[model samples]
Target: MTNVIFTVGNDMRADDGAGPFLAALLEADPAAGWEVIDGGASPENHTHRIRALSPKRVVIVDAADMGLAPGEVRRIDEDCVARHFLITTHAIPLNFLIDSLRETVPEIVFLGIQPREIVFMAPMTDDVRRGVAALHRTLVDGVGIDSFPGIAE
Candidate 1:
């Protein structure tokens, strides 16, 4: 099974950029099997790209407004994501896309990093940066990708 992950967010927006930054970090790691996509705060634009890959496991990383304490990272399922975050684009809502696709695709999951602020033209806040780092550690050192097969080494 092909393992794929998509990072969608606007790097210009403080905490919102966490997604793209994490994507960059994952891309830099050769052992992490993922497709880094700069969704730029909108996932709609990348729907086609995802369709082309047709991965078995699809993980969408983004900054969400779950109303939790800022910088909190949560791995939300499809049912909860829409209620928490608007899920603007990132290729036609993974659930909807999956329904539309006749061919069997991959399992889709969402990992949302709570963003303190999504304001324009600002760098990442310290809390958001720390959050991403901590979250990455979970997926890397903790889960170790090895347990996930294609996701790690």
Candidate 2:
């Protein structure tokens, strides 16, 4: 079964760039099997492409304000996504995108990384960078998301 990763964020923004940064790393890795889509600030625009891929699983990565320390990562449950993602830069609600994808994608996971800053054109904070790098390593190593640091419920 095919698995796809949809990264949502604006690279121009500081920590909000986590998604895209992770996307770049995954794309360059020759051993990575999942398709990576850097949705940038408008992941809704890529809905058609994701549907076309017909992936069995779709993982959405984004910078979220989960009230946690900077660089913390968590698997945000669908029902709790809106609660944690308050400062969104996307054009539409992520929950909406998830709802739309549910029709075609059997499984959807939202990976949220707590961001320290999201200023426009600012460099990503070290904390968030480390979080993104950890996530990248987890993906490239084919490790379960549950094994990632700060992933506990």
Candidate 3:
């Protein structure tokens, strides 16, 4: 069964670059049983590609405002996404994207990294960078998402 990670964010934005940053790391040193897709700020555009993969599981990573501290990472519940992600940079909401791929992808996970700021052309915040690094380590080590901390209620 193929497991895919779809990262969503804008590299030019500060904390919003968390997804792309992790994508780059995973691309450099990929993990077994996992495929990395840098969805950038327009993950909705990649639904066709994801459908083609017919992955067993799909993980979507993005910077979200969850009213948590900067750099905080959480496995966001699909239903709570709208409540927590009040502001989004993407053209289409993530929930819609998830729904679109649900038929092809049996399982879907949404990982959110709290952003400190999202200024255009600004570099990623140190705290968010650390979060990305932690996620990278977890993926590369094949430790599984269960070992990662935080799960939004």
Q: Which rank order by TM-score, best down to worst? A: 3, 2, 1
Clashing pairs in 2: none
Q: Model 2 compared with the native: what TM-score?
A: 0.92
- For candidate 2, the 10 contiguous residues with the lowest summed lDDT are 144-153
Model 3: per-residue Cα lDDT at residue 35: 90
- Order of candidates by lDDT, top first? 3, 2, 1
RMSD of each: 5.5, 2.0, 1.3
Candidate 1: 10-residue stretch with minimal lDDT? 144-153
lDDT of 2 by residue, 1-153 (tens): 678889999989999999999998888872266888888899999989999999999989999888889988888877777655646798999999999999999999888999999899899999999998888888888885666443323
lDDT, candidate 1, residue 64? 75
TM-score of 1: 0.75
Candidate that scores best on TM-score? 3
lDDT for every model? Answer: 0.66, 0.86, 0.86
